[model samples]
Target: MALVKVQRAAQITLPRQIKDAAHLAEGDYLEAELTSEGILLRPVSIGSREPSPEQETEILAVVDQERKAYAAEHHR
Candidate 1:
C-alpha cells in the first residue's frame, strides 16, 4: 500500500501506482468511502441530466429479458 500526506491546502496527491492502477486522470471525479478498515476511493461519474426515453426503454427491456431467463432456468 502507498502512503500519501495531505497538504496544508487540504489536498492529497494520489500516488503514481494507485493512479495507474485506477486509470485515473485529471478532472476525474472520485468518491471517498469511509469504512472500519480504512478509507476507500472509487471513481464515479457525476452529471445532471435525465436518461433519454430510448435508453430507459432499452434498460427496462434488458431487465425483463434477464428476469425471463432467470425464471426459465429456476422454474424448471
Candidate 2:
C-alpha cells in the first residue's frame, strides 16, 4: 500500500510508483468516482468527452442505419 499526502491546495501528488503502475502521463484524462470504500481513479482515453443520452441515441441510430444500408447493398 502506498501513502499519499494532500497538499495545501487539497491536491495530492500521485506517487511515481502509482503513476508508473497506472501508465499515466501528463494531460491524461482520469475519471474519479467516490464510493464508500475510497476514491477510484480510472484513466480514460484521451480526448474522450461525455455525450448526452439523446446524442448517444442519435449516434447509435445513425450507425444502425449505415449498417443496414451496407447489408442491403451487399445482399444477393
Candidate 3:
C-alpha cells in the first residue's frame, strides 16, 4: 500500500501516516525479521536503562508538542 526507497545506509524512513498508525516515535525500538512472505518490522520497547536528563527533556518536549497537536485536531 505504501512504498519507501532505501537510502545510502540501507535505511528507509517510514512515512508519517504509517508511523502514526503504528504509534511509533523517534526513539522507539523495532525488531526486524525476514519471514516467508517478506520483511517484518515489530515495535519493541526494551527499557535497558533510564534516559539521561537531556534525553528526558527532549522526549517530554516532543510529547508536549504532539499532545497539543492532537488536542487541537480533536477540539479537546
Candidate 4:
C-alpha cells in the first residue's frame, strides 16, 4: 500500500510506480468514486474520439430541453 497527501484543490499525485503499473499516460481520464473502505479510481474512455465543440453544444441543448419538459410534466 502507498500513502499520499492531498494537495491544494484536493489533488493527489499518484506515485510513479502506480502510474506505470496502470499503464497511464498524459491526457488519460480517470473515474473516481467513493466506496465504503475508501476512494476508488479507474481509468475510463468515453469514446474513441472526443466530441467537437459543436457536438457539445448540441448535447447540452438536448439536455436542457429534456429537463424543461420533465419539469413541466411534473409541475402540473
Cα-based TM-score, every candidate: 0.56, 0.55, 0.61, 0.61
Candidate 2, 1-76: lDDT as tens digits:
8899966434578889989999988756567678999999888773445556786688669667866775677675
lDDT of 4 by residue, 1-76 (tens): 8999977435589999999999887756677778999999998774544657886688669767866886787679
Q: Which one wins by TM-score: 1 or 4?
A: 4
Spell out the clash pairs found in candidate 4.
none
lDDT of 2 at 61: 94
The residue-by-residue lDDT of candidate 1 on 32-64, one tens digit each, is 778999888898764423446785587569667
List per-candidate RMSD values in Å.
14.4, 17.0, 13.5, 8.9
In the range 8-65, model 3's lDDT, one tens digit per residue, is 4346899999999999888786677789999999987656335678877886797678
User: Each prediction's Cα lDDT score?
Assistant: 0.72, 0.73, 0.78, 0.77
Best by lDDT: 3
Q: RMSD (Cα, Å) of candidate 4?
A: 8.9
Model 4 residue 7 lDDT?
Answer: 71
